[model samples]
Target: MPSKFGFIYHEDFLKYNFGKGHPLNSIRIQMHKELLELNSFFNNPNIKLISTKPCSDEDLLTVHTRDYIEFIRKLSETGVGSVDDKDTPAFKNMFEIAKTAVGGTITAVDEVMNGSILHAWNPGGGFHHAKQDSGGGFCIFNDIAIAIKRLIKKYNLQRILYLDIDAHHGNGVQEIFYDDSRVFKISLHESGETLYPHSGFEDETGIGDGEGYNINIPLPIGTFDEAYIHIIYQILPLIAEFYNPQFIVLAAGADAHFLDPLSHLQLTSTTYIRIAELVHGLSHKYCGGKCVLLGAGGYSLNATPRIWSLIVSKIAEVELKDEIPVEWRSKYNEYFNENNAPIRVVDDNPPKIDPERYKKISKYVDEITNRVKENIFMLYGFFKLIK
Candidate 1:
């Protein structure tokens, strides 16, 4: 199965783990690699496993402030405070851990940009909530933004599109490029009405020259797969036809799976794979086959690795012929309460799609999609008025 896809990985990434019992912990990364190896997936000769050097201070300065970088460096060495009001907590060595994660993403970006790979993936990246000088939501620096800056600077990329499918709104990423027209952001998440970070409203389009470049679809809790596929089909193609970016970054978060403990969204593993395929196809169609993928949130003990496995297999286009690996399951049995861990290739049954919730979300999706269409027309009329 030797192929052209590139994967970003390094052993140092696991050292950045939060202390034991944190929701975002080190076990997730270890298990993902273990499953790939146990199943003979990464053994394919076509896929290249790589370790990238840490991004330099100049790289960090592109999207992060100098004072913030210095503060983080000192704090990483010795700090015992919280980085956010909730979620991201400060601890010793926070700087090195966060920096390594940012560097992993940069390495992925550089691989794709330099013609070494067509697509690159870094499961340790996607720290979307950190602002230029501040940390929040368990994120210390904005990896996606740093990568975007690198692309723009080195390649002179004119337009970049960021699509976040995480359960939480990407308020930090959205605010980072709020006034930069070269970036177009679209986020589909559990509406702030019920989720954390509580931003991403319909009217919060881009400002100034970036006006209308940012798009947000805040969904209600409990929405399921079919509704997700239908609405995304509509909007994604429209985005492909409209913004036409040079490349797209997918903030593909698996926590939206129904089994995840973090949020109330009810999507299944299949949905994650389908979205990955769509993003890959759209990138090829519009962005010259260049795509950068990042893993975000997923917390269900049994579901996290399975959902990610499905996504990786689909995006990487590898076929699986059998059942779950015994060694991998045995290791996590105690941690997962034994009975609740994934024991088969896929879940025994599809997640409950909740008809009532699906209907409500369809209504919301239809209304919003139509309004976006209508607003495009209204803008045209305004241009005529000025003339």
Candidate 2:
């Protein structure tokens, strides 16, 4: 059978480094690829690995300002100064690498749209913190927004769904599509009051025709798998069914993992896989399996690779061993000079939250979920509600 899935990747993708000690190291991409290789994901006939070219200026201009684009290009050539207020820095040839990241995601979109593949993944994309004229949070280009614009303009399709499960809010993507009714953007992120960019709240729904099109579910810090999974299962299916989207775009960031130092949301590999499975099922049920997955923020060297590998394996319909491949583990130990590299794909059990506190947090989350459903779903004619 022809391949049903495409994996957009290239060696040059590893060049989008933000320098030493930056949280968004490109090495995590290599680690994920190596883990997948060790699991023999490449041997599957239904999955194809794809290489992509840099996006042209015109393609980028569809979402970013010409001045911002030129600024990045100039910095890339000169190798001086920071790109944003502070968090995102300019690296040598960063302009080209960022363009390639955008191009990789656009390429995946094309594969899915043309019927060459039912689903596609670009581990190099999902720089959701970048905006039209600036970059932030270690992101140089808003790949997710640009690709969504391309899909709408090229295909003339309406009702696209953008789902972000990253630890931080997808403020860039939300801002880009805030006034557009055709794209429905939903983000489940750590509360902006506690995270970077600090803006995704329950009340930031869209304006004008785009009103009720944008949904944000901001969870409190230290949220665990049970509450996280419950909120997703309750709201996502209802939204997908009501929207009846033409395509689904997911920003599958692994920074929410408990081991990640940047964020406090307590998720694990098991929850990550379940989230992927839920999204995959939704794609097939609503959009003929036309789903595009993009990599977002994931900082923990140990958790990031394993989380992404689980997502890829789930997408490829392959079974993976719980134990990390011995060769990969040994290599990790030698490279990091640490003898305590994880020996298994899954994380050790996360500590339990205090019972009274857990109950209070769950109640708050449920209230937020109900508020979203009430405010948005009623506009879409979903009256039953999740009580």
Report the lDDT tens digits of candidate 2 across residue range 178-291. Answer: 999899999999999999888999888999878889999998888988888888888889988888999999999999999888998988887898888998898888998899
Reference-based TM-score, model 1: 0.93
lDDT for each candidate structure: 0.79, 0.88
Clashes of each: 3, 0
Considering only N, C-alpha and C atoms within 3 Å, which residue pairs clash in candidate 1?
Answer: 2-46, 3-46, 76-95
The lDDT, on a scale of 0 to 1, for candidate 2 is 0.88
TM-score of each: 0.93, 0.96
Tell me the tens digit of each residue's lDDT in model 1 across 1-387.
323567778777676666777888757777887887787777786677888666778888998899988888876776676776577767787787777788989988888888788778888888888898888877888989999888888889988889899888888889989988788888888888898888998888889977777788888888788777876777777767766788889888877878778888888876787787898788888987788888777777677777777777777777754477878878888768635667775666767656776678888878887886666445445666899
Clashes of 1: 3
